[model samples]
Target: MTPSTSTNLTRIVKFGKKPAKRDARNLKLSAILKAPPRLPAEYDFDVQHNGIPTPMFGNDYHGDCVIAGRAHQTLRFEDAEQKKILPITETDVLKEWHLENGGTEDGVYVLDSIKLWRTKGWKAAGKVYKIKAFAEIDRKNHDEVKSTVYADIGTGLGFSLPDSAMTEFNAGKPWALTTKPPNKKNGHYVYVPGYTKIGPVCVTWGRKQQMNWAFFDKYCDEAYAMIDAADTKKKKSILDGKKIDEFLTKLKK
Candidate 1:
């Protein structure tokens, strides 16, 4: 397809509730979607330099792709989270998930978490992901604002792409895939490490996955990228997982 064509940016990650003011995020991403894509390349989320490597974390069966995805994003930078980048454990992801939802088997929801964290400066399920310090990469009217949660790339600490889905970019490969009937396990929220010759590279489950321009055209629905704000800190909020189950139960009444 040519660079001017528009593609759907819808998603498959389920949310019990919907989000607000998603127009700007979606519209900006649509333009990105229309941009020309590069081709024939490989990406490693580990950020290797010639041979040296950086470690990353993976997900578990209980549905923590969102957490794993966020963790991988942090590992992309040398000093993400205001400290040295390290492999963020799935347990770290799970612990924060508990704090956010009280550990009630909520799985992962991209829209609600992203809008709150990326645009409104709320904490991600994992405390390590401080949306407060990160800025939204793109917005419809970003320059008009004097001071805002979102900013240009140079100023933001790290950016996040919200409301995207994981679809099968290639068939019969080790790479994960999401289809129209959408594989239940494949649907996910991923961290955009950056673009590649193929298209955008998402760090998912501790590995790099490519969504080429054509793949994005067919499966990509919505997205937002958060950039680092001017300030950066390694401090992370902490939460206890054991109490999460009990806390959520108490709220039911």
Candidate 2:
């Protein structure tokens, strides 16, 4: 169903994030980075570069938020660290979604998506992109979330969304805690590449969305830090040498 904004513009949004899955072998952010750096009180990765406007990546018509979120994170990581924007297209995203989700419009579990990202990788612009590793984040720790963005580590969030979020999103307003109950059936995923003092800034439906910390804590059920292979090649300090080796070793098992 489409939701109308104050301007009477119809906004079509599709949510495809399933509830988070757990595995005992999954790496934890706390275990990887013992002490993260102190970051500025407010920071935004989007402002660091002049990339093109965010794309919906077919999210407007399909339940491909998982793949769309990956595409968004790839754009941000390439622009910020590689100094170039990857030409990711809607077709490219949908192709990956089909492969990962078995050609279904049904949603995906965040863990399964990340595993595919690390193993099979995704193809965009005729090039394959892969992440070196991924670790679960403490979604309740506001400071940890901020630090991940500041450090240039890509972050993906999976959350149960409340119905009122559609109105707030259509109005281009920050998502805040509301009395409305969250609907797990509306599980959605977004890539958060930046944050301001108010809260994390996520890319969804081709727009930059800001959500307060309270709202994040309330609805954000799963969070992860994706270490891009390029970042590792550049020696980005997502993990020290010893820790990265240990982490990779664990993943191999």
Give TM-scores for every candidate, taking all chains together and pairing residue i with residue i: 0.50, 0.91
Question: Which candidate tops lDDT?
Answer: 2
- Model 2 residue 51 lDDT? 58
Q: Rate the local accuracy (lDDT) of all candidates.
A: 0.37, 0.81
lDDT tens digits by residue: candidate 2, 1-253: 2211112367887888888798877887777674666678888778877654699898888888889999988887777666888888999999998897778777888899899899888898788988888888888788778777877778899988887788899888999956788887778999998888899999999899999988898888899988875244323454555676687886678
Error (Å) of candidate 2 at residue 72 is 0.7
**Model 2 ranges with Cα > 4 A deviation:** 1-8, 229-238
Q: Write the per-residue lDDT of candidate 1 for residues 18-78, one digit (tens) a residue.
A: 1122443232322222112222253333343222222233243344455555555444443
What's the number of clashes in each of the models? Answer: 21, 0
Pairs with backbone N, CA or C atoms under 3 Å apart (clashes), candidate 2 = none
